[model samples]
Target: MGPASVRPAVLVDFGSTFTKVRVVDLRDGSLLASGQAATTTDTALEDGYAAARRSLDPPWDTARPELVKATSSAGGGLRMIAIGLTPSLTVEAARRAALGAGARLIATYSYELTTADVAEICALEPGIVLLAGGADGGNRTAVVHNAGLLAGSAYTGTVILAGNRNAADEAAALLAAAGKGCAVTANVMPRVGELVVAGCRDAIRREFVRRITASHLFRDAAFPVRMPTPMAVLKGLAVVSDGIAGVEPGLGTVLAVDIGGATTDVHSVGAATRRAGVVYTGLEEPHGKRTVEGDLGLRSNATGIVARVAEDPGLATRCGIDDLDRLTAASRQLAAHRSTVPATADQYTVDAQLATAATALAVGRHVGHLTVQHGVTGPVRIQEGKDMRESAGLIGTGGVFRHAADPESILKGGVADERWPSSLRPVSPKFYVDREYCLFAAGLLADDHPHAAFALASRGLEAL
Candidate 1:
């Protein structure tokens, strides 16, 4: 490695609530300085970026780095709509790709498009449309039909065409003829039970960079935005699983839970293991998997959580929550003040309870559930999600896990809840927290400086 300050780069993540900045020594991956400021949504995010940049204490006075890399979810992140042929086949694959690409799914449609669907699309006005249908060599009718519908609609957002390979050219031509922007990627479901997602994921990342760069936030910046915050976190987790520079020992299989204001995202990277008597259905699970639960968040979706808990007597009893009005009041208070620090132990407990509920619900949805089905042939046990029983590590990110008074206990309770379905839960995995919020920065650096990214990520995380 060169001198400590030889090549320093600034990493920034623009969250909806805060703008985080980290100055790192590219030569050694040591964090030189870090700062955070309230994210400004009224004006260009550049204002908040400038504030965070100026807030850094050290190295700023001595070293001036020209290279600045960033990721963002400031303005509600990336919203997406998915259209596909079958609800359980290609449509499900498209949904997975959209979430993996760091997008919030506003809506999903399968089979033929209707006039009502067109009106909803116009109303939602998503940033991107993920058009997927049919296997690579199996079918083409649904994809072609959907392409025509989009081409004739009022939607002008970029369309990522990832359907049957034979139908790709026709889909693109249809969109192009109507003067609509679209990107053609590899088939998401190349075969009946196989999912190919890397192409679509990369395409969405490129589109994210393009869309953000075109906005007022980073339009004048020297370099384009790298990836969405969630996407970068997912990449960083992969780095954690796969050893960097062939030196660090790999953490075999790991799961990460991020509890945020508007969503709780769960990511797991593991080897697919088949149970003795269970049968896998639909597409096989990817080695790296991500599932986002928008209805399960601490702040923005707290009301939903409150209602869910109230509806379930057992869950409410376990959470020690009663009085629906009081719970709703607390949820509203936290929602209004996104950055509120718990003033008392009671306040802290309430916050931790919310976090625990969010984590459990999100993780349960992410992992697969088991069901017994009696088909014409015979009885079979079918699994619906990625199994994580063999995960070697469990990571907790976001404000609650990072800043809570007793984060360790909160994470433990969330992971060990029996209320969630038992098909896919971590089995005594090592727990860690991203205390300094370096996961995204590490992910941004993973491609170029694997070893350095590994070092930076390991430093910010505290193994529990």
Candidate 2:
């Protein structure tokens, strides 16, 4: 527990599929050793963590550290329900805040919460509920009503009051009086057409850590569990975009695609600009954003990805998957045996194509596009999602990218797809891989030693 002992630290990420540990020289951001073990989801994850510790034998096995930091995506991550004044304004902002904090948004209710809505939320059993409505000085009726409804429900999880400032105190008091845990933060939509997420994002992360700490699963782990795996990675990505001294100066705009067994997540950090004559009509897109595609994955959601591909002509053919039945069967087999690695050339090909499709689909959905239509006043353009044409880097992570012989090809193919409705793409950018799975670890380090975290992350990746 001394400063010298803290020089060497252990950083672990408890992912759904794997438990990874890294021993690092915090002084210079040097990686000493790393190990991995299959995550023990049904039982305590400590078993896997211990196994991983043993796998890093000899010096590391016998060495003592001053710190044990962890980030996790276990148990489907942090599930959250969001309730807001309207679907387009406060509701959307609340959803963004939740997602930015690395929470899986399970459900969103707009306007006043109904008895049926409360019943469904109870059934869903989210770890947290994000209640946001109105603007700073705007309408407070909807947000206050929703708060009272949630307080009277069977749900007893943490409820975050992030709405009209005038009503937040009352909402918090009502929830407290009802024996419900409540936390208050700044309004998600402080003003009409303006989205403020930093406050709610931080609050959500704190509540999620509190919820995770209270669970028996994390009882034996380290304190100050920085954040969820994805959130940490997002923070690390932000660092990459912003740069740190003695590390990367900055990458300008960057896009990252992480393909997991159950979902594909896309994260981007930078400014979004309209190209030529296109005009964005929707709410402003946050510079640092994350989007999770639940139905696009290699294992559990393989069939869903296949079905989407089937809907698109020439996609299967481009992927060299001619037999739809064979592909579907293969996907089901992978789903049933999630740990199985491709043992045959055909299987490997199928995996690469699946990875390609998943990446493409995720990016396509994450990026904004422009559409032309006639308006009462004149012809207008509508834009949706974030524009990434000016991105300076494209990074790929996770099992698919890590195990592939030519992972860059998968990313290249995905980005080159003509089906993309957006004018901006990572058409030309530096490519890198999270070969050592240090993204989350770097994120965990960012809070205390930002420069070291950036340097460690820079040394961890290799150009693809």
lDDT of each: 0.82, 0.83
lDDT of 2: 0.83
Compared with the true structure, model 1 gives a TM-score of 0.93
lDDT of 1 by residue, 1-464 (tens): 22543678789899988999988877777887888888887887878888887788663642357467888998889899999899998899999899888888889999988878877897899989999998988789888888888899999799999999999999899999999999999999998878889999999999988887787665465554788998999888888887664589768788888988778898887687788988777678888888888787787788877777777767666665665577779998877876677789778778888877676667767777777889998988888777777778888988888878777665664454567654577768888998888889998899888888888888888997
Collision count of model 1: 1
**Stretches > 4 Å off in candidate 1:** 1-5, 59-63, 219-223, 320-325, 336-341, 372-380, 416-421
Candidate 2 pairs with clashing backbones? none
Per-model TM values vs. the true structure: 0.93, 0.94
Best by TM-score: 2
What shift in Å separates residue 396 of candidate 2 from its native position after superposition?
A: 0.8
